[model samples]
Target chain A: MIEEETNSRREFLEKSIVGGLTALSAASLFSSCHGDDVKETGEKVKLLSPDGTIVEVDSAYINTNIPELHLSEHNIREGVPGKKFVMVIDLSRCKNARKCKEGCSKMHFLPKERSYVKVEKMQDSEMAAPYWMPMTCFHCDNPPCTKVCPVDATYKLSDGIVSIDNNRCIGCRFCMVACPYSARIFNWGEELYGLNDAEAKAIPDHDACSSHKLGTVEKCDFCPQMGEKNELPDCVKACPNGVFYFGNEYDDAVTNGDETLQLSELLKTKAAFRYLEELGTKPRVYYLPPVNRLFPFKDSEESKNS
Target chain B: MESDFKKEHEKLLDLTKELMPQKFGRTGVIWVISLVVIIAIGLVAYIHQLSKGLIITDMRDYSSWGIYISNFVFFVAISLVGSLISAILKLTHAGWRTPLTRIAEVIAVSAIAFAGLTIIVDMGRPDRMINLFIHGRIQSPIIWDVLVVTTYLVISTLLLFIPLVPDIALCRETGVNPSFWNKKIFKFLSLNWKGKKSQFFLVHKSIRILAVLIIPVALGIHTVTSWLFATTFRSGWDSTNFGAYFVSGAFMLGAGAVIAAMFLIRRQYKLENHITDAHFDKMGKLLVLLSLVYLYFNINEYLVPAYKMKHGEAEHLNDLFTGHFSLMFWSVQFFGMILPIFVLISKKGRKPLPAFLISIMVIIGAWFKRFLIVTPTLLHPFVPIQNVPDAWKSYNPTWEEWSIAFATLAGACLLMTIFIRVFPIIPIWETAEERGIIVDTHEEK
Candidate 1:
């Protein structure tokens, strides 16, 4: 009986994969010809909402609100369940081109002066090589920032993402002080010039958890919102050199938008290490040390003097 | 010889009449009006801050906390003087502490009140202050501070009020004829004090219990404040010595503030017989002792860390010892600690005028020391600051920040001044008892 159930489930998944692809194509093709003529067919199909409620709707209206459904605030804090997400950055591929920073700023609608992700030009010692280091919130298992928040406004979720609830945050900025990486940035006042309110409201909060109020602290959320739909984070997609790889640790697979690799093999082969590992924060983000350079390190305007 | 004793008895009555809470003269009115104006300006600036957020202040991501925090420390330090003079000195049976106790308690009550207010001013969302109670976790140092500060304030007020009961009765019986409102207040506050044996026993016993209670709570308030910084992994704040360091420094400043208050009260009210040069001499000796203890902690706070020159401590120590903060740092060390210690240590220096000057120096130094403690360490976080505006890399509190911080100081002083105007700066009942006055039962009002 168990074998029979498993066989039926596998067969249903296989059939749905084929049917779903065709449905996607048909929706895309017919969406442009919207005059209510498609509704005259009176054909209804069963569909499941993102929150798992099934409804019988005409096929044309099926995918209209699909984008908005995945970006719910409830799921933003709950995060992508059963998945321990992680990121790895290849230092060799980075040559001081700040596209990742730019992409982060753009996706989060951050002010030019304040970007959640900082690209630091680091040199370990006088004798060591200087390299461009892109630093964002490591989303550590033991996040000191969340530990210090008086209101539990910033919290580490079960699925390996540390996020802030701006609505509940009392703007004490203790988290900013607690962060060793200096990854957190405070919205000091009203950000009037960047994304307007309507534009911000239109973009679902889960995209990067972007809409922030003055006095709240903001940091990179690792784009779990993007992870919900199997899409790469904006920074991973934006990097011209494919410097960032993001994936699920449970699945043991990671991707840099263009290529997917086995997580264990890549980390072991590349000798990847987490930043400030001795601090014992246990950051999910890893880095492949700058060995065998793809391009020579060039000092960008963001790079400060050693 | 018998006539001489009667003359001394008459002199004591005259002292009571003189020490009654008098109406403020023209100069007092001017002083109060100026403080009110300053506070009004601060309120306006705070309104602006509320509308604009904390952006008006120079605090940024790097320098997340600034003068508001330091000002908070200063108020908490000054408030500790109340506990020191009233509770600690009383417990130790120090005779000279009687005249200074009321002044110290007044300072404690006002400074702690403003300390609570100043912290709220520092909070980014004052509106969500209730959340402190709703979601307050015991693990956070902030919750500890709130618990202790509130506890200290209540105890400190009771400490002040319980002793004032007999003084209020004295005011009513001596026919000082205070204002109608003042009379009603004193009448209600006096609690029908006939000064019977049982009442005296109950009041003294309650005071003794509170005095013992306040010592731990006072120590807790400053210790928790130090923990707010020390709990962080930042280099300068990451010290095992911070709690003792803060407590020691607080006692030194508290003593300095009490000396200043004593000098002013003696000079202003002309209470030479009550608050004599001997009082100043004893306080000066106490000041010297506290300063030496604080200076010892200062060495431990800075020198021991500098000796090893660890990776994180190197830059922060360098900044204080020789870098941009060096000028302010050296001045605070010399004027705040060293000069005051030297001046107060000598027999000639312990005179009223000289001791007052040294106490002023110590108080000023203590203020700047708090600023140094809060700002410099924050500028040098564990991670090197990068990719930020030049302004964020450094902090200089703007005019609004300055106005609000100074207003809290002025407000504390204003509260103390009003308190003095309402009640005798010296405890009349204690003073009379010390002078061995006979107590008549059921005295006519």
Candidate 2:
């Protein structure tokens, strides 16, 4: 069955390679013939809308909207103005469900085994009870990774997001060694994700979260592309138990899709703390201690297999 | 008095004849061929790596650096020999250093040159190496390393070349049965030296200046290399004594390398008179001193940390002391440091054969020592390794990494071999001058 699946995948890739070329020429030809009159066939078809609802639409109404390009390279380096993004993970609610990991991998187009966020089982001592902690890039205010980068490939932006410019990364991996939390991941080889080079390049740079260059470093980017539209990151939206809360520190407001709370008040009430806070990295991500847990801790399937 | 003068002139002639560069014999030809073959294989592996990525090596996200980086550190460590022998000894007026200075400089140039190349091989994107200069941040220790390594290379090349000018002039004048092309190369490189008193004075002045200038630069190179690790927050790497630790270790490795080269060159060229047993004995003493200094630093670096056994450091120390890497760790310490000190401290062991064997052991041990320093620290990171594939937790270099690493070693040897083939390994003019046989250049012309 696995061999058969691989054979079909290879066949699909081969067809796409050929079909992609034809589509490029056809697109140009259709653009050149734009002034020609169109005659509606008066046909209706069932289609899946963006919201996953079935809809019957006239053929004339069915048109593809090209994805809008946002954030030039310079603009990405500058980051979103007047915003300081932060995150607070509520450890009490987390029970290793792993929906956040799944949603993050799906949104980023990563493979099943690779993920930006990992849910780990943590026990302070042998006698203490274990709890599930979902770990992601802390995006420290004083990022050690950026300081050790030989080239200015990784940098801290004014908006509190630590960003990487893969185009400029020399792939020395010094930044990886310098990161105390092991937040960075290296692209040791090609990560095509089923798209050919040209097809991958066709996606806009800001929106193509998973089209990572070979031999560069990548990590959780806080879903800045979605931030432009004032939407939450995929992991924040995917958690059923509201384990993750993301917000703007400047506005002092944070949300977990189900409720919004004052960031400072919540932190003070919960006695939140950053991981390895003594390192003086000043991480933007905070974690509330797992007190009065809502769900019992259980090992994840992935953890069990390992 | 007249007969004494003629005798001195004839002795100078014999000295030049004995010291001139000779054509390669059967063994030399085989050595060159083997090095070239190794280099060719390495080139093939590097090209494959370029087309693919660093995935050809055993490195992963957690164990991000492997043998290539360790090899780079070894080269950098060995290159420090040039500064130690030529600069420090020369400044101290150690007159017996004449025969070994050129050898030390050649080793430095070749080792450092390959040191730079090995780093590029370790990089995931070698093609984007230009970005290091284009977008270089001065704050990065890597940039400081690059700057200092380049500076040391230039100064070392000059230190090698300037003193060789009078020697090259001798090679040009005597011809030495060199091929036509070699004759031209020698004549051009000689820079029209008349060996006048003024010329000798100028050479000595320049040599003195470079010898003095290279000391701090040499220290900078190794200290900055140490900072590459020390500046990081990793438990094993973070320490105040790292700079002194690396510098002292580099000196020991450098001395070992020089002793090994001295023995081989003495055997190959049949220059028993020039590189005598006394040189070996003195070098043995020097190696013992350096090894002891390095051992002292090693204790300071490891013992204090082991005693405390901080939260994250306990796991790393145990892994070295009694865990998975215990074998390699103990072997490197004993063979690379303790055993060498024990063997070289005795008069019998300071003989050419035993010293050579022990130096070879030191070299091999030094290579693995670097590996121990780099790989183990990475395996035990601050956070526990979990949720990833088990393979990512431990590092084992593949055949490609080994091949490429050996190639860099072979490449450094090949460079030195070619250098010895072209230029006199022992400076002929300087040797004669030291023996008080100052022949008149104008009268000979």
Candidate 3:
């Protein structure tokens, strides 16, 4: 009755049709794809995994793409797909492994001299217990940084990640002054860390800092490009302890690349919290408490060299 | 002062140069040479910094700003002197300002020029500086600052230059005619200053225009600069008093710098009769007024925060008052604000040398005060300082930053030094006109 339409390789990669992609990830736990579990009809629709691999699946599959993942970089600057992003970091679980810091720095090619995501040692009082707390870009809804930037160098993405367009940064350091979280960093000279050329090849050229010229401000982008590959963020996967759960709140689910959990359920169960909540930053990264310390803080004066 | 004034306008007294717009003698030469050497060191250090990066400076992510910002603020603040002592006094018809006006204008033009350049030095990415214009977001206060500062620079410069046309023309009448290279500049600059009634009217009108234009821009320049910090969400920076604070401090520093420059010009050029002790006393009194106003704002800036001690303000205040930066903060407050105000309040302390020293204190204090304003707040943000290294939590300036900062300071000095050598630091025609000693050959009619 209907003219048989050839399923496209491109359409198969689209989020709406990329379900039943069990060959790629269980991240696609959408129910539409699950209903076909009884019918072993590998109707063979082409698919791409978050890990840079391609696959084929049936046309009736559902999509598991995070809502924020679908928006373009321009759209991200405008804000998340439907709702504003916010996070509450629980003060219990952070021992400052700096996995998030390392992942962000590696992604941004931040100079060795500066750390955009710092793990600050916090002691409420001299008598209070000391904890290693990880700090990051708050991705403020009313970002003080974007407010002070002389040029429109930094902006809020639609996915609620505050990103810097380094090419436009005038390097006034006024943003640095304006930022209470100290998430922004200035490129004082050359891109001394030497951008990883190979990292770009792993994705497209659009994903690398090398394409951008030197002398710009840079910080965490939360690895949104990795989302383009339909994969979890580097920090969420690299933390051997599973300290971070990178996810979308729209679906109320989060995963650490290995274990998946309900976002609201995890926050309620673990007592999650946010940093500088009073400042009204509306940060996007939540934390669990540091009640269980996995490792003793190897504390020494951390100099810029370290 | 009386003896020096007696010999100021006559033949050279031993070492002093008696030439009109005067020649530099040995003291001036050595002074200039020292500034050049200092500037050279700063230049070399800057080159090294350019190669090595801002890593040469101890300023880390925590103390992202350092003396460079403070120094730049100092330059901006001190530049206000050009308007306060020159245009404002002229507008009010204060006759005693004749000797001080040149010094005030020189300080204003020189400091503002350095302010313009020094801001670029504070940039972490100087190479991408054009971004301020290409993608400038009007919503950002920094764009407003860039625009306002640029406008103020143009206005401040014209305020200095327009009034000097007649004096520069008088110099052109002598062997001081610009060389072939400078002739074009001198010719264009002179623009037919034959001292006709019409010419005087036009010049007077232009000067009035610039004087009027400069006042608001001067206030805007410093107020906007203050907004650069106040608009931020930091504890120390989130104060309503900042604009007034900055304006007060700017006028104080500018007045101090003017007094110091005027004293130096009078002493070196043997202009005691021209400059006079009366000029010093008046400047000293005005410096006191500025100092008192600055003190009031400083108290407001400090005491108001201290009294209420808002959630995070305590640590920042303690850091300035009794903690890490207490000593430096107290020193600046004492020397920059308190002592100078006290010194100039007394008649005898307003004497040339005493006032000169007080002015020096004001300049030095105001400079270090900027450092306190920029650094301490950053050191104590809302959250606890952590991560990375202990050094990262604290602040320390590296030698490279110091060298570059000091070099810019010296470069400012050298600019003033060279400027004095070529142009008359005193307004000769205005002084001659005031004395009713016109040299026009057309008087025979």
Model 1 residue pairs with clashes: none
Q: Which ten residues in a row have the lowest lDDT in candidate 2 chain B?
A: B436-445
> For model 2, how does the per-residue alpha-carbon lDDT over A106-188 read when each residue is reduced to its tens digit?
77766667778878788888988889888888999989999989999889887788988888888899999999888888888
Runs in model 1 deviating more than 4 A are A1-77, A191-197, A200-210, A302-306, B1-15, B438-445
Task: Please provide TM-scores, in order, for all candidate models, with all chains considered together.
Answer: 0.89, 0.89, 0.82
Residue A300, model 2: Cα distance from true site in angstroms: 3.6
Ranking by DockQ: 2, 1, 3
TM-score of chain A of each: 0.76, 0.73, 0.67
Candidate 3, residues A1-306: lDDT per residue as tens digits? Answer: 111222332333354334432333334433354343545455656645644567665555545553443334434345434333334444455656667666765655554444456777766677767776666676777787877776777777666777776656666677777877777666554545555666434533335322244445666566666654446766566555666666766767777766778888888888777667777766677778777666664554652233
Give the winner by lDDT: 1 or 3: 1
Determine which window of 10 residues in candidate 1 chain B has minimal summed lDDT.
B436-445
Misplaced by over 4 Å in model 2 are A1-69, A191-199, A207-211, A301-306, B1-10, B443-445
Using Cα atoms, each model's DockQ against the true complex is 0.47, 0.50, 0.41
* Tens digit of per-residue lDDT, candidate 3, span B1-445: 4454334322212211233455679998899888888888888887877666676777766688888888988888988888887678888999888767767877777788888788887776778778776877898877777787788778877767876787666566554534784566666777777655566667778988888888888889899889888887788889889998999899888888888887888888777887788888998998888778888888888899899987789999988989989899999888888888788899999999999999999888888899999989888877666544567677777777787788888888888888787777777656665765532322212
RMSD of each predicted structure? 6.0, 11.0, 7.5
CAPRI-style grade of the A/B interface in model 2: medium
Best by lDDT: 2
Report the lDDT tens digits of candidate 1 across residue range B1-445: 5566556546556667978877777778898999998898888889999999998899998999899999999999889998999999999999789989999999999999999999999888888888888887777777788999999999999999999997787777677766798889989988998866677778889999999999999999999989888888888898889999999999999999988988887777778988899999999999899999999999999999899999888999999999999999999999999998888888999999999998999999999999999999889876678877788899999999999998898899999999988888898767877877643333245
